[model samples]
Target: MNPILQTTINKAKTIPISEERKAILQEFIQYIQQKVDAGKTVNLNFICTHNSRRSQFSQIWAQTAADLNGIEAACFSGGVEVTEFNERAVNSIKRAGFRVTKNGLENPKYFIFHSDDSEPIVAFSKIFDDSANAPTGFAAIMTCSHADENCPFIPGAEARIPVRYEDPKAFDGTPEESEKYDERSLQIASEMFYVFSKIKK
Candidate 1:
């Protein structure tokens, strides 16, 4: 693992998760465990309205957590509508120690690297069922209330888990913009670490 990302994970391991949040995250843990027990590959698709922030954070952190825990899982993020991954969110990921590189113009794709040995996570905004994502037998992790409510059905999802997060976009243009984005990123990273930590494998 990258030393910086390892340090970030060490910090995230200590962040507290509320009892209510644990209850919600437990569902995700169980889902992954079931797949692991069955010797099946785990596929997780984090979903949000714009796929610009929360969903992106969830996907990246979840994959990193799974990798750290020696679990095999494919993580992806998408939205109800296409919009580039928010720059603020991308910066927050960089602050968390992931090396990121941007490509393309409008709705640019981001290559996020947590470790030099692992393949970079190619991230961008697209519909939940975009061709790049798994077509079936994946968990649909709803990362925002809007997308959860609006997307009544996610075709091909074997499980639909709602794990909503507050929008740091609300603080955009405010003095606390960066702080809020970092806070949300850390919160998601901590919870994802917690989820993977529970796996017996």
Candidate 2:
């Protein structure tokens, strides 16, 4: 491992991540760094079936992580089709401590909830209506298998990276649901913080 990576890795293990998960988190940081350091603005589109739970988590944390680590990047989300951003996901991120604001409530354009200091993470049902609203030739990030295979080609994406995460939605409606949701959200936040902490600039 790079000496700097080792120094920052200590931050990740402090979170309750398994060996495999910790590795995934590290690799993701490295991937984003490699992409962004090329003097390019990285547009990461984290996708799920509904553009709801897992993708939403990735969108906020990725932007927050980029800001905390001083990396310039943009994060977005999409589904194979149109659907609402899940409320439970929004509530989970809020409980995990994101700055959430409903900009266009009820027929509004989007719901922007992000750290005020960070580049706002944009969450919508599909790709942004305007190309200028996003990075041209963005990176297609598949957060779920359904998206990974179903959508083989994301228009204008320079690359596609699959960074799948555990779906706490599986626990929905069960006794342990809320606990799992919050637990998973914390886990995502901690790992993201660890990643941003790794960047040199």
Candidate 3:
């Protein structure tokens, strides 16, 4: 692992998850545990309105956490509509210690790396059911309430898990922009670490 990412994981492991949140996370925990016990592949698709911030962070951190725990899982992120992955969110993720590489112009692709041995997660803004994603048998983790309520149905998801996060877009272009973005990224990272940490072989 990159030393910075190892540090972030160490810090995330120490962050406390509230009982209320844990109650909700337990549902996801049970689902993942059952899948792992069945020897089934676990796929999670994080969704938000724009795929710009929250969903991206959730997908990246969830995959990282799963990797840290030696859990075999694939993570993806998408939105209701296409938009470029916000640069601010990308910066925040980089600050949280992932190495990132960019490609393209209009809707550039981001390859986010957490560890040297794992393949980089390819991320960009697109609809939830984009051809890049698995058509079925994946969890649809709603990372923002709007996408959850509006989408009504996710074509092939086996589970629709609501794990909403406050949009850091609200803080964009402000003096606290960087701070808020980093805070949101760390918050998602902590929760993902909490979720994956519950898994037992």
Candidate 4:
């Protein structure tokens, strides 16, 4: 792992998670555990209204956490509609010690790297069922309330789990814009680390 990212993960493990939240996260843990015990690959697809913020953060952090814990899991993120991956979220990830390469202009593809040894996570905005993502046999993790409430059904998902988070997009253009974005990113990172920490590798 990248040294800075490893440090971030270490700090994330110390962030407090409420008992209520832990209970909800347990459901996610159980899903991964069952797959591992069955000798099956774990696939997670994070969903939100736009694949721009919360969902993107969840996908990156979850994949990094799984890798740190020696778990074999594939992580992806999508949304109900397509929009460019918000630049603010991309900046937040870079600040968290990732090496990011942006490709193209409109709806640019982001190659996010947490470690030199690993392939970069190619991130962009697209619908949940985009051809790039697993069509079936993956858990659809809802990362925002709007998508959770409105997206009643996610076809081909073996499990649909709601792990909602507040939208930092609300803070966009505010004086606390950067701060809020960083805060949300760390919160997601902490929770993701917590989830993988509970699984027995």
Q: Pick the lDDT winner.
A: 1
Q: Find the 10 residues in a row with the least total lDDT in model 4.
A: 1-10
Candidate 3's residue-wise lDDT over 56-128, tens digit each? 9998999988987889998998999999899999998888788899999999999999888779999999999
How would you encode candidate 2's per-residue C-alpha lDDT over 60-154 as one tens digit per residue?
77776676566877777777766666676776666555556665554223444443444456665554323533545576678888888788777
State the weakest 10-residue window (summed lDDT) of model 1: 1-10
What are the models' TM-scores?
Answer: 0.98, 0.77, 0.97, 0.98
Task: Report the CA-based lDDT of candidate 4 relative to the real structure.
Answer: 0.92
What TM-score should be assigned to candidate 1? 0.98
Q: Per-candidate RMSD vs. true structure?
A: 0.9, 6.0, 0.9, 0.9
RMSD of 1: 0.9
What candidate 1 gets wrong by more than 4 Å, as runs, is none
Query: What is the lDDT ranking, best to worst?
Result: 1, 4, 3, 2
Q: Distance (Å) between predicted and true CA of 21, model 3?
A: 0.8
Tens-place lDDT per residue, model 4, 1-201, is 667877777777889999999998999999999998988889999999989999999999999889878999999999999998999999999888888999999999999988988878889999999998999999999999999999999999999999999999999999999999999999999999999988886
Write out the backbone clash pairs for model 3.
none
